[model samples]
Target: MNKLSLFYLLVMVALIQISVPAITVYQNEMVLYKGSEFLFKTIPLDPSDPFRGKYVTLRFEEEEFETLDTSLWQRNESVYILIDKGVDGFARVKRLSRKPMSGNSNYFKGRIKSFYLADGKAIISLDFPFKRYYMKESKAPRAEAAFERALRDSGQQTFAVTHIKNGKSVLVDVKIGEISLKDVVSESKND
Candidate 1:
């Protein structure tokens, strides 16, 4: 092909490649800034993935939902989890749906980790999309230690601050009470 044609082709390919990630970042930024915020109670532990590096693995208390029809859901199926604030102000699963809510924006996408019948009700365990809060290699171990200590204390509250909009969610921060986990680690270092 002509050099001018080749140049145009390469430029088109490059634009297409860049646009995908650009759109993703834009969407995530929008969610972080303009989306509704929810606090999800967390039980965390530290783990290192060889490919992804160090992160605090988060398990939410609001991962299970019960329904009467077990046949409607399947393992590993993508689902929309509708959330609403509980009496204590933490996010709770309001319902699950196969399709996105038409007029509501208070849902995030997740997968069904597993399900089982119990007392004729289907108990579904969900796999949240945002489960890893990555930290610098140096800070992760300290953060995990502090998180565990906070979790052990009955009075301390550990939770993740997440923002959700249009089926997308961003994990803003993990906090113990009003202080963030990063701040907690930093404070421990100062002590």
Candidate 2:
């Protein structure tokens, strides 16, 4: 192949590699927002990465699933978690199943990272796909500090706005007691 042709090919390949995942993520985000909304509680552990910019590490409280039959469950097995609204209207995992439940139930899929039987209960830990929310580089640290302070002082709750559709899940936003970090930073800037 000619040098120019080879160079163009390389460039096209690189662009595809980079853009495909981004496009897929964007498409999934669209589906998620239009699908079903859920809320999951979180703890603030934001840290800045030079390459990845700034992101908050989300540790979900509802990562564990309990089942009566541990024998059928295997580590790294794909599991479907049915979601339901709690009394507070936040989405929570109703149950874990080997198969996705039909009807009006909303569900997301995850892999079982670990499972064990204890006291006749099958406890499963999942590797949820949506775990981090990338944010603007400048705003992350400030938001993280403010979120941490709120968490420690007033016992504030940080919850993630999660969206799920067709067994795929995406995190939409992280709210520090109902205020999104983006809004928090913007308001702070205005004030």
Candidate 3:
């Protein structure tokens, strides 16, 4: 092939490679900046992977929904969960949908973890996309300890602030009451 043609081919390949990550970053940034915010009640645990470094794993209290619809749901199948705030201002699942909700942006994409029938209703459990909150390595251990303490203390509340837009969600922060987890850890260290 001619040198000019080879150069053009390489350029095209490079552009394609760059565009993939660029689009993903752009979408995440848009959600973080312009999406609707919601607070999710969480149960957190700290775990570390050698390759990925340290992060806190977050499990939501509102992962299950009860419905009368008995349609078969396959594990790992993509689903949409509509969300609305509870009286306490934490997010709750409004409903489950096979497809994205039309004209509503307060929903997020999730996977079907499992489902079962109890009494007269079908209970659906969902796997949310934003499960991991990565933190600086130095702060992770302290954060984990703080999370554990907060979980044990009946007076403290731990929740995640998330932003959602167009079926995508970003985990903005993990906080104990009104203070960020990082700040909580730092304050505890100073005491």
Candidate 4:
């Protein structure tokens, strides 16, 4: 740790801090299980992506919609959103889905969703913008577990979740739940 080396290390740390993503994650970032909320970590896992469609994007993280802005909402084309627990324990978030779900709990179901971090606040973007991320700092045990799952679950690294706005990732939210890729796709179909 010579003076120059120490300065380089300090600069690297600063860059890392600046480059980290901004997101509100659940406990352990392992909200993959339906009841995972029963146990959680304030921190979440890193954000990732394989690719996205032209009109939509997909997300897989330790935490789902965590924090959100309820002002921007619609009921037609899917929009991304984060659910902030209202006083009633019923989740409330920005209406990301283009159209509201008719008798469905998941409006943006099947479609890709994103949680954006802006102005120290969070916003979500639904749909696809291609492979992009902000890689938030999630150090929870669940985050690690989710990461391991991402790697070994698919026998490959399945990245976390992140949202991009104007070509720049604004926020990233880790996903959690016991729903498997098949289950997530089928869960909405059952509805």
Top lDDT model: 1
Q: Write the per-residue lDDT of candidate 2 for residues 139-173, one digit (tens) a residue.
A: 87777777777788888778898888767788889
Candidate 1 weakest ten by summed lDDT? 64-73
Best first by lDDT, ranked: 1, 3, 2, 4
In model 2, state the lDDT of residue 101.
75
Measure candidate 3: CA RMSD. Answer: 1.7
Lowest lDDT 10-residue stretch of candidate 4: 33-42
Candidate 1 lDDT at 47 equals: 91
| lDDT for each residue of candidate 4 in 1-191, tens digit (9 for 90 to 100) | 68999999999998877656422233213223222121112222334444531111233332344344444433234443323334633334434444444433322232334455666555544443222323322223233454455556665433324332211222234333433333333343455
Task: Assess the local accuracy of residue 147 in candidate 1 as a C-alpha lDDT between 0 and 100.
Answer: 79
lDDT of every model, 2 decimals? 0.91, 0.80, 0.89, 0.37
lDDT of 1 by residue, 1-191 (tens): 99999999999999999999999999999999888999999988889999889999999988977877667678999999999899999999988899899888999999999988889888999999988999888999999888777768756999999999979999999999999999999998998
Candidate 4 at residue 97, lDDT? Answer: 42
TM-score of each: 0.92, 0.78, 0.92, 0.20
Ranking by TM-score: 1, 3, 2, 4
Give a tens-digit lDDT track for model 3, residues 1-191: 99999999999999999999999999999999988999998888888889889999999888877788877788889999899889989998988888888998999999999988888788888999999999888888889888888778855888999999879999999999899998998998998
Candidate 1 achieves a global lDDT of 0.91
Candidate that would win on TM-score: 1
